[model samples]
Target: MTRVAVIARILPVLAILVWSLQGVSRAENALTLDLSDYELTFEEDFDRLDVSAWGPGTRWIAHTPWNGDFGDAAFADPRPGFPFTVKDGVLAIEARKDEGGKWASGLLASVDGAGRGFSQRYGYFEMRAKFPKGEGTWPAFWLIGLDRLTHTSEVDVVEHYGHFPGRYTASVHVWDRKTASKSSSVHHRVLVAPGSLYDDYNTFGAKIDADWIIFYFNRQEVWRQSTPEHHKQPMYLLVDLGVGAGWPTENTPDPSVMLVDYVKVWARED
Candidate 1:
């Protein structure tokens, strides 16, 4: 009976070991990629915002100067001919008085056909940033999916205008190809103060699970949306310091600043 007792104990231990190994194997099979271990996936300490590493994904397609543009005019202030500078580890997309006698300094995303590549399905996305505070400066940290070379599905994780202090906006855009227009569904949430985004750095993130996209400000959930049909495609990230669009037009003018510390992506560890 001593031998029988030993066998019973050994069988349970072996069975538990096998079960644990199976669990680990399933986790390994589910992981596609993980950016947490990568140190150089992002460029840092920029003395000047470089566009070389960026691809056909970076270009100026349309601006306030473009007619019939759906973007906000208050935020459309691209300095007519000059470009913004990134120096001393800070990116300053400035608005100054040019010889053209127009106050211009605006932000632009990766052009339709150039710049950063694209991501399709679900992943973890995040950005650390401090926005500018003047009456009309609008800043945004967001993402858009390049659907076979067209801007069809866009997601705005955070969009803040100077006029709306202590609050950030989130939205999703669905393009109507036939009508040449886009349908936007959006939500606005107030951020915690003292920790307000305008004065200091804060981290914003979104975890796009299989069927749910949850928005977080400074790591706290502020909003969530469920759309299983569209959450499976990869999407690229975008960070822009826009001036006077959306809700910034309602306030006064002051030289605002948008400071981005870093953007990071991550995945679940098995």
Candidate 2:
């Protein structure tokens, strides 16, 4: 996810909490909603890359619903094997440079501009992925509010930059379209051992409810903040292999690939 305005000294750093996962246990590989007091609502194991369907009633679109393509790469549409590929139940979102020196990448949204697809008002959303390592590689999993007429609410589950080896950010933003300003915003950084994220797959998740929005790394709580008022409505999902987040992409890995094992969401069973 990209920030709309330049975060100068004006935007206060709400929290800077760090949890080192040095010796964390990696038990319980299987994901289940029963123990969490929730029910499975949506899941995408990437059995296949369905590019033919890219609109309302479909599973995904190639770009953001608002057509905002951020970072150093253009979110390219699905092609033969350029930006997207599926093999053995894994989805690889690739970023590469073309002969013309233009960078193109892949992004997938759960809904289209017409506000049709899978979305939930509040739930626990998770993505298990292995991030690409190299300067200028930006991978993110985020959510945006469905109601885009007036204001917009955003929840960034995980935004990892390649330069920062074992650090990622999660944030919440409430932007008012009429005033073009963020009414509420908060940013937090989570840290672990350097280069640990690039070695293997890890899970990043967020739990959103009426009172708070909590972030989790490997299913462990890391940070939390009050849920914005505008975010109470249903929101859709987006995962992308971006290029640069206010950094240089000249030395970026030509074919940086982000492998996603799965994306799943569970709604409270109440």
Candidate number achieving the greatest lDDT relative to the actual structure: 2
Q: Give me the displacement of residue 267 in model 1, in angstroms.
A: 3.6
lDDT of 2 by residue, 10-100 (tens): 2453222223233232323433332368899998999997653357556888888887777779998788986889999999999998889
Q: What Cα-based lDDT does every candidate model obtain? A: 0.51, 0.81
Off by over 4 Å in 1: 1-48, 52-83, 101-103, 106-120, 148-151, 179-184, 246-254, 268-270
lDDT of 1 by residue, 78-140 (tens): 333333555567665554434654444444443334333434356667788777767666677
TM-score of each: 0.66, 0.87
Candidate 2 stretches greater than 4 Å from native: 4-35
What shift in Å separates residue 192 of candidate 2 from its native position after superposition? Answer: 1.3
Query: RMSD in angstroms, all models?
Result: 18.3, 5.0
TM-score of 1: 0.66
